[model samples]
Target: MDRTLLEGLFRHAVAQAQPALAIERHLPAPPKGRTVVIGAGKASAQMAQAFEKAWPGEISGLVVTRYGYRAECERIDIVEAAHPVPDAAGEVAAQRLLELVSGLSEDDLVVALISGGGSSLLPAPAQGLTLADEQAINRALLASGAPIGVMNLIRNQFSTIKGGRLAAAAAPARVATLVVSDVPGDDPALVASGPTLPLRGGRAEARRLAALYRLDLPEAAQRLLASEDNLPPEETDAVFANNSVATIASAALSLEAAAEMARGAGLEAAILSDSIEGEARDVAQVHAALAREIATRNRPFPKPVVLLSGGETTVTLRGTGRGGRNGEFLLSLAIALDGVDGVSALAGDTDGIDGSEDNAGAFVDGTTARRMREAGIDPQAALANNDAYGAFEAIGELFKTGPTGTNVNDFRAIVIR
Candidate 1:
């Protein structure tokens, strides 16, 4: 029953961020000329479908989402591609997107449905850079423990359709961007590297960050980062004259919904934060401390309370791990909370994936570690090898949600009773 309740909190967070529920309310009016919709993200396909149903006039366009994340659409075309790592399919789609937005006039409208994962789903390598170059750098950044903002900034430098380049191509055509923000600050400019929004940093900033993180970029990627030509256009450029952006859904809003759900269930609830970011294991330790405090002394909150938080966390790969950030977080948390009674927790990526695994995340209580030990699994050893997924899988404690069709970031909840 505690597991069910904890999962309920996560579901509430995810449901609140659904594009179908939020997109129509934020959409711009239909244009007098052509209305072209172009989007990329885990939620873009659903956004297109919702927009299609809401529009009163003719509309046509394309959107790209992660493979197997495709949603059915009639007027707008939905394309599936690789995520976290761009692919040949994404490269072809990126080229096509630039062409679609070009040759348009002020009478036309470019509706950009942007969200997290869009940055990777549209992998248009900039001039002199190849898709392979982008992919290698993207992989490196993911494992470097760099924050999402820095990662996106670096990716923006290597893309032909990001950092306001997409909107620039639609010059003379008004752009209306609706976003599902997944970054720490909910900066629409950082969502999917701000493909339709002008994010003002350039090659210099990217190079500085790359050096700071010791990123190993391919020769072409390194050269591109060092070149003056790789900088994004100025924010005051005329290309952005008639553009507008709206954050339709975000981590803060999602966390609020989860908190409300807890309250509705007659539990006193508190939201710790909606924008925490750092190494996953480190963040888990902080969360465990909070949970321990509430459970042992009830100083922060009374018993029968649930604490909720939302944000993206990073994983610096040190071992041959087979799990994502949330998995790493849960394993560390379980170890810290071991044998502490009446405290249970759940952490999941709202998009229904916790790293590369099928599980959204996992569930844990004070008994989690002891249970693992009983099953002849050393929890600490598994975490050391970055094998949290394997540990949880061996015990059938994995939490799987196929695809929630939306993304607001990570949803974490701790229940103490």
Candidate 2:
């Protein structure tokens, strides 16, 4: 019953952060010239679909999303591509999005439906760089376990369209971006690397981030980072004179709904934070300590309460893991709890996909570790191999929700009863 209710809370959170409910309320008025919708993200397709239904005038555009994550849109063209890594399809989509917005008049309105996963979905490499080079840098960053913000900063230096370049291409036209933030701070400029919203920092800042993360960037990317030409447009640039941004959805939005739902269930709920960021295992350890405190002493808020949080946790790949950050987090939590009674938890990406794995995430309880041992699964060994997916699957506990068609990043809940 705890697991069922937890899943319900997760679904409710996703529903509250959806673009269908968000886009209409924030839609820009119809432009006198034209309304061209262009977007790139895991949720961009759905945002476009929503925009189409909400707009009062004729709208035409295209949006790119990860393969198998596409949504239906009658007037908007939906393109499928790779994610977490760039591909030829993504490169083409990047070029096309720029072209579609180029040469627009001031009377025209460019509505950008932006969301997470746009970084790789629209990879327009720098002047001398190639898509493969961009892919190489992305792989290194993902493996390095750098926070999403730093990774995006480095990516902006090597991309032609990122860091507000997308909005710049549609210069003189009024650009209104509807964003679904997946970053810790809900900065629209960092979502999907801010294709439409320009970042404020310069090349110097990008270099500092690259060195701070010790990012093993490709040769071309390295050169671009060294060159002054890699700098993104300043906040005062004329192209941004009439541009606007709306953070229609985020982790905070979902977390609020989940908290309300928990209260409705007759459980006291505490939202730790909507912007939690750290290594997955480390984060789990901290959360476990809190849960332990509440269970053993009833210190924090007492028993029969739910602790909720939402953020995209990074997983440092030390081994070949079969799971994403959420899996890693749950595996580590299970280890730390080690059969502490009266506690159960669920952690998963709200996008319905956790990292590169099919399962959104998994469930862990006080009995989870014991169950793993009974199934002949070494929880510690599985974690060491980064195989949380395998461990959960063997015990029939992998939480699979498929693609939810919307993304507000990660969702977690701990029910202490």
Candidate 3:
């Protein structure tokens, strides 16, 4: 249970979750006619490349991904856009994608590659709403501390392409969606707002979410919500519907792979939960307690145990700090596990980029507190500023993976001996 072994386990888990291998193996047969590939998400570009390799016939279309995640695709055009926030490029991509599917006949196939960040990558604002308005709304939502489910629910209400609307636009054509699910439950409707599915909920949920989050709706959005057209279901066919929605990869799957790897390395492994949610700092405290239990009392588990969990956590934006959710979670954990022995942990988003920062996440060994103490950095103060990335960077503890070209939410592993 040395530092190198613990770190290797974390890296192994991340490698198992990369989209190239995991996502490429889940392809369905290319349609008899033209196969029109369309997608949006952090991994859509990588997913598109996989589609080209697996398809038997001709394929052409577009898939938008977060900046720096684009892969080379001959027939399928790959577009890069902003994530966690919508941009004009995404707006254009959404319009073009809608156009691409609109002309497909029943004989054609619309292979929709979807994953996390699709909501922001494929943002085509509803009529009367501008990209700026959408951006403002998105900024507000991210800052509101709402869970992904609630945030996507609200997003679906404001977009013309989300919440199954994309599937509707490709009516008559057979549509199959291949997804790398980043959501807790892997619900088709919740992953990137289920672009290839139909909206099933009413506007009431969106209305309640806005009010609950104290979000100020623009006039255009408010007007649309009041209208009857809000979240109206679009017509779609059932051809190849049985296996149309397939989750090629998920956070739980990645975590299990990590746990197995850890066990093989002579460490007892425990997977806490893959659907953990709520505040990042709060979740870290709970994880810290579990680490301590394994290190000392061994009440729930014995020594030489590695605790693993996967799920998206939220930061309420209390301070103007720079970091993603994973970094924040590690900072909080480091504080809680301060001066504790034989406990080390790594928490990071499966996607290389975390939140608005470029770092994947941060890692903390048993000496994290000691290192911070020597540097005169207050873990508590850093946590308060939501500056986990800053603190970790100052101490060279930030984990940087650039872009793994996938998104399956967060991966957290703690090894205690």
Q: Pick the candidate with the highest lDDT.
A: 2
Q: Give, for candidate 1, the lowest lDDT window spanning 10 residues.
A: 224-233
| Model 1: per-residue Cα lDDT at residue 389 | 94
Q: Answer with 2 or 3, whichever has the higher TM-score.
A: 2
Clashing pairs in 3: 164-197
Clashes of each: 0, 0, 1
Candidate 1 similarity to native, TM-score: 0.98
Mind giving the per-residue lDDT tens digits that candidate 3 earns over 1-417? 265765676677667766677555776666667888899898888888877877778888999999888899899999999888888899999999989988778778888899899988887888888898889788888888889898888888888888887887887788888888899877767888888876456688788778888887777887887776756464343533433778888887888888888888887788999999999999998999888877789869888788989888998988888998898899989888888888888887887888988888877976786788688888788888988888898888887778887888888888887
User: Model 1, 1-417: lDDT tens per residue?
Assistant: 289899988988899999889877887977889999999998888888888998888898999999988899998989988988889999988888899999999999999998889988999888888888989988999889999999988988888889999999999999999999888889999999988888866677788989999998999988777778757777899999888989999999988888888889999888988999998999999999989998889867888899888888999888896888888899999999999999998899889988778999999999999999999889999888888899898878899998888989898988999
Clashing residue pairs, backbone N/CA/C < 3 A, model 1: none
**Which has the higher lDDT value, candidate number 1 or candidate number 2?**
2
Off by over 4 Å in 2: none
Against the true structure, candidate 1 has what lDDT?
A: 0.89
lDDT of 3: 0.83
Q: Put down candidate 2 lDDT per residue, 141-249, tens digits, no spaces.
A: 9988888888888888888999999898898899999999888879899999998888767789889988988888888888888888757787888999888999999
Task: Give the runs in model 1 whose Cα sits over 4 Å from its true position.
Answer: none
